[model samples]
Target chain A: MKISAQEEYGLRCLVQLAALPDGASLTLPQIAEREGISTANAGKLMWLLNKAGFVHSTRGTKGGYSLQRPAEDIRLSEIIKVLDEDVLNKHCGSYTGVLDSCVHNGDCGIRPVIIGLHALVENALSQITLAQLVGNESSVDAMFHKVHSIHRTVEPHGV
Target chain B: MKISAQEEYGLRCLVQLAALPDGASLTLPQIAEREGISTANAGKLMWLLNKAGFVHSTRGTKGGYSLQRPAEDIRLSEIIKVLDEDVLNKHCGSYTGVLDSCVHNGDCGIRPVIIGLHALVENALSQITLAQLVGNESSVDAMFHKVHSIHRTVEPHGV
Candidate 1:
């Protein structure tokens, strides 16, 4: 399994927006320069985030894009869902062979293992909010560790 | 993130070989038939497995392919490494933008989180051997749960 380029860039741009001051916004050119991506690409990413309700854009000069909600309210899982939905669905259907569904549809050992891993990943992503990522590298790193620690602590034991 | 078709089919094919009696082998047609894939595709997957030393091929009317090592000795991490090395490497390099390396090479919060998640996934894969997947769906599912539970319990807390 691997993270797609769109997901990576989109997340980085989101983190940039999260680090901005309250009510402040970033233009596409500004985001592209800081993130080292093309302005067009940044606009595309922002468009997607906007459509997904993660970000909002204002018109005219002095207007740009900002988070639609508080950074603390936005989860990585939601971002991944918006950016990687097609890829995830394609992954689910890829191993079914030439058939409409998997050959082992009703009884698949591998499927459950994969599904379980997906759940674990989603759980981890859900625990991390954009606010947690809005800091210096060390602080963000620490925040993730803290979030993951609490996540593990409350995991259903022997379930 | 998503699992590639090669990884999926390759793992399923390995599980098929793993379920065989010791010294027993399966022809390309047999594997393809059981997995609902084309014989050519099965042959290609088997070729990769053989090249990676996960399986051995014997050329003869009665001979076919068999596991190179015991199922219990073959971990999922090794399989993924063989199948997805290129994709994983590309994933690492994809988000570096126009620079030769990532702009935040030494101080990237996102990198650490991704790296940490990769380690977590690899650890989980390492804990699961092919033998554990050579059962019915429910039994294999239970095996994964048990393995994951032990894994979580042994995790270094607050580290």
Candidate 2:
């Protein structure tokens, strides 16, 4: 399975906005340079984020994009939902590329596995705020490690 | 996120083989018809599965395809690995679609979240055997409910 390009890039862009000082904004050009994406792509992402109410734009010289709300209040789950409503639908589509429905649409063995994973992912993302992701890679990595250790102790999945 | 077509079709095809009686096998046509896929596509999927040592094929009119090992011995994790060695790589690719690497390659905040989700998914799939998937949709769905309820109690993620 894989995260969509829009979800990944849009999230990275938000992390950039999250890292900004309070009330500060970034231009599309700056975001493009920092994220290594085309300016047009960055603008597209920012536009979507803006329309989703996760970000607000300012006009004129020195004006740019900033988080609409505090980073601490923006959950990754919310960001993902804004970026792609078809997260699970995209997965289900793989079962029948040419058809609109799957052969096992009524009762699918794979459905439960996919749904369970989705719920777990949603739970994990719900616990993570963009504020948490504002840290550099190692810090964010450490945070996940801590959470995972706690989860392991609680469940002890012997995989 | 999305499961690859190869992974989905390959697993479904394997489930068909798993449901066969002892010493029984199914031809490409039979598999395709049962799964509502094209015969040529079925042949492609079976070829990959056979090459990965998950299934064996016999020649002649009465011969066809069968699992190389018992269904109970085959884990969903193994099936996924056979179908996709670049599963995580594909996700990483989404970060910088145009460039060879990401801007935050050295210290990426998103890396940990993706890695953590991958580990969780792997752990969950590892616990599920192909034999478990041989059941029809509802039985398999029920099985996941039991597992998920146990997981919920053990972890109690509020989300």
Q: Pick the candidate with the highest lDDT.
A: 2
Candidate 2, pairs of clashing residues: none
lDDT of 1 by residue, B32-117 (tens): 98888999999999999999999999998898999999887888889998888655456556334332455655434477557556
At residue A129, what lDDT does model 1 achieve?
74
Q: What is the interface RMSD, in angstroms, for predicted model 2?
A: 5.3
What local lDDT score does residue B61 receive in model 1, on the 0 to 100 scale?
88
lDDT of 2 by residue, A31-148 (tens): 9999889999999999999999999999899889999998878888788877886565566564334325667655455666666667666665666778777664454455445545
Candidate 1 chain B weakest lDDT stretch, 10 residues: B150-159
Q: What C-alpha lDDT does candidate 2 achieve relative to the native structure?
A: 0.74
True contacts kept of each: 0.25, 0.32
> What ranges in model 1 sit over 4 Å off?
A86-100, A136-159, B86-90, B93-99, B137-159
Give the per-residue Cα lDDT of candidate 1 at A4. 80
Q: Candidate 2 on B1-159: residue-level lDDT in tens?
A: 556778888888998898889989999999999888999999999998999899999988888999999888887878887787667555556333432455776656677777766766665576677777755445445544544454344321222
Q: Candidate 2 — which residues are off by over 4 angstroms?
A: A89-100, A105-107, A136-159, B89-100, B136-159
Worst-scoring 10-residue span by lDDT in model 2 chain A: A150-159
True contacts kept of 1: 0.25
